[model samples]
Target: MSSGQGGGQSGGQAGGQGGPGWQADGRRGAQYPGARRRPRYRALSPLREHLREAFWFAPLLTCVGAVLLAGLTDLLDREIFAEASAAQTADTLLSFSSAAKSVVSTVSSAMLTFIGVVFSISLVSLQMAASQFSPRVLRLYVRSRLIKATFATCLATFVYTLLVQLGYDDTSDPARAVSVPIVSTIVALAMVMLSLALFVLYVQATMRLLRVPHVIDRVTRESLQVLQDYRWLAPELGPTPGAVPEGPTLLHEGRGGVLRDVNIRWLIRVARRHDAVLYQVPRIGDFIAPGTPTVVVVGGSAPRPRRITTALNVGVDRTMHQDLSFGFRQLVDIAIRALSPAINDPTTAVQAVDRIHQLLAVLAPVHLGELRHRDKDGAVRLVQPVPGWEATVDLAFTEVRICGAGQPQVTRRLAAALDDLLRITPERRRAPLLLQRALLERAVAESVRDEDNRAFALTPDRQGIG
Candidate 1:
């Protein structure tokens, strides 16, 4: 006999508090009136992640390379100076045993100073990037990056020049002697700084340029309020089971089949749920009207006993979890908003805020659960399953279409949003207050999109605000 054990879990009828799941006024009850509302998910942002990685890597590599190059150049310069002048300037002297040794020494000293500055800047950059949806934070990040990149470029150039001088003779022509260090360091520093600068500029300029944040903010605020309102409602009612267990009959059995034939499995499971006999249905999501044969629940034989117990520990399990997820997301949004400054360009700060809003919306499912209703005669019926539980589907940033050849909308949006969100907030945050403001923003955007769409459809040349 095999050592492995086999078991099957029994399907039990778990009772739910019966009634309609959602009340028409958009309130589950007094407690969770508007809590069912979920935000629409737009997409993910990758620009911040890329920026963070680049920020850290650039400085680390620059520091190490600069020091090594400096030391080697210093040694060469020492020998040249000694030979040319018949004397040595203290600054031009090299004490290391070899050019490699001098290079290492110069690199170490310069790196010690540069790393401290660059690393600190990188840390701030990362924090701001993570919370870049807030205008205040975005500004801080942009400023810090600008300052660090600028300083690092200068420092790297200076240190690299000094180290390069080590590799040449001081007496060689004074002009030529000066040219090598200056050019080498300047070129290296300029290359690094320029690349980083473009990124920073893209982020800052795009944020103010795009105005996506404002739209996002409005959508998010409306969604959050709608979801929050739902939490105040009464609990959902679940479907009631038939009076007793009805079937152990095999509807269909198969060992192998083609890919499309897998529909047989679903038929069997659905039949099992109803304790009924079933056959394959060709189409899905088709409606069954009154008197239609949905499935035949076998009533002749008793179902086989299952090894596992048929019981449930069900008090606010998944429903609470879902609600909490929405709640926490809302809180996070509020926190981000609280951290945002009032004054920022719409393209940068507003778009940044909007992106976060969209992210939060994606978490919302159309409906949470179902409710069953009972008529005066005690006949049971499923009133409705929670409606509109749509998942916001999207690929992660890198997974989406990208071509190194051109600017990407997601990255462009990210850069802009980050710049605005990182700015320092000029005022204290009031969570509830912000929520109201966001609601207003949502209303405005909704009206704009609707009106614009209508106007554009009506006319070729738009007259005014759509």
Candidate 2:
């Protein structure tokens, strides 16, 4: 997102900035307001960069050579005729110039049309390249391609015009005319076509070459998603690799002031957005990592918690126990209900599971460093992150403590909301199973009734008993 153009244009690192920078505190500074510093490095000169980028230098040079050769041929033609009939040669040369003047003018006009065509093609190529690359890197690439294309097009047009004009100019003489052979003319035209074709191919190759990194980045991001979805089996929780610490962890500091008791309401909202259910451990305060299903979301009606995880594989560490003494089991059940139906059907199941998992990943492992909590003195404090990766629950509890008994009610409300969501998902698959069961029950009842009627018909005493 820097202002400067990049890629081979600067011969610097593809996206590298020329210096040092500051890491984000998640807020842009006042003076710098949303500005990020560029990385430091020296880049190649523009001319060299241009040469490297176009990758068309060799083809361009070939065209230039053709133009030069045509000029030389014209000179040789004039020399050969000058010795034989000076006066006649002069007259023929004059006529040839007159004839060529008009053609030259027409060719120039044609070239103008070609310029438009080239421009349109170049724009399309740039657009395609931008879309093909990462969104973050597109604009820079477009600018670079546009500049290179414009320059190359102009060079090609000039060379082509000169070469054609020289061909016509080379023939002169009345008695001993030095006219171009039809075969030679055809060959010259063919060479021009070949050169142009090569130039275009070069540009295409260059664009494809630049796409490699973008492809890799996309792959890496998707891989991260796969990791989250399967985190249930991973040794560590969250994007980073590490286990959440057990017992009392320091979430942050401050018994009072701007930061105080962790704002449970706001945290709950965040949890919901991620589709995670939050359960706070009772009396443990915000300072201790608490409970399983710390972040819960509805899933399929499995008898046991499956080895489910997230695409980002981030969230509460299943192995570490956060002592969430609060009766949050209800919230966990609700989340399970909400998530259950979506996962029952195979088609949309995985995506729904991943989405729910992402929600949990975002909220559950929220460490104490990410929270605000209060001390016994009524002083509020802000927790800071510790070294390395830790489960969000562990991190949230690391340096925080709970305040007041009213907290459980708020937690209950969250649980209720999740339960409501689950009810909406409705076990549609379960409905079919229920219908099947009902039909089976009806058939049984009918059979029993028929059997009793038959028996009564066969035996009058049994019938009376029936």
lDDT scores of the candidates, listed in order: 0.33, 0.33
Per-residue alpha-carbon lDDT of candidate 1 for residues 277-378, written as tens digits (9 for 90 to 100): 432121112232222322223443323222100110112111111122332333233333433354222234223334453543333322234322222122
* TM-scores for every predicted model: 0.27, 0.27
Give a tens-digit lDDT track for model 2, residues 319-391: 0011121112212222232233332222121222223323333323321121112221222211212222223
Task: Indicate the worst ten consecutive residues by lDDT in candidate 2.
Answer: 5-14
Q: After superposition, how far is residue 119 of candidate 1 from its true place, in Å?
A: 13
- Model 1, stretches more than 4 Å misplaced? 1-61, 72-154, 165-169, 172-361, 366-466
Task: Estimate the TM-score for candidate 2.
Answer: 0.27
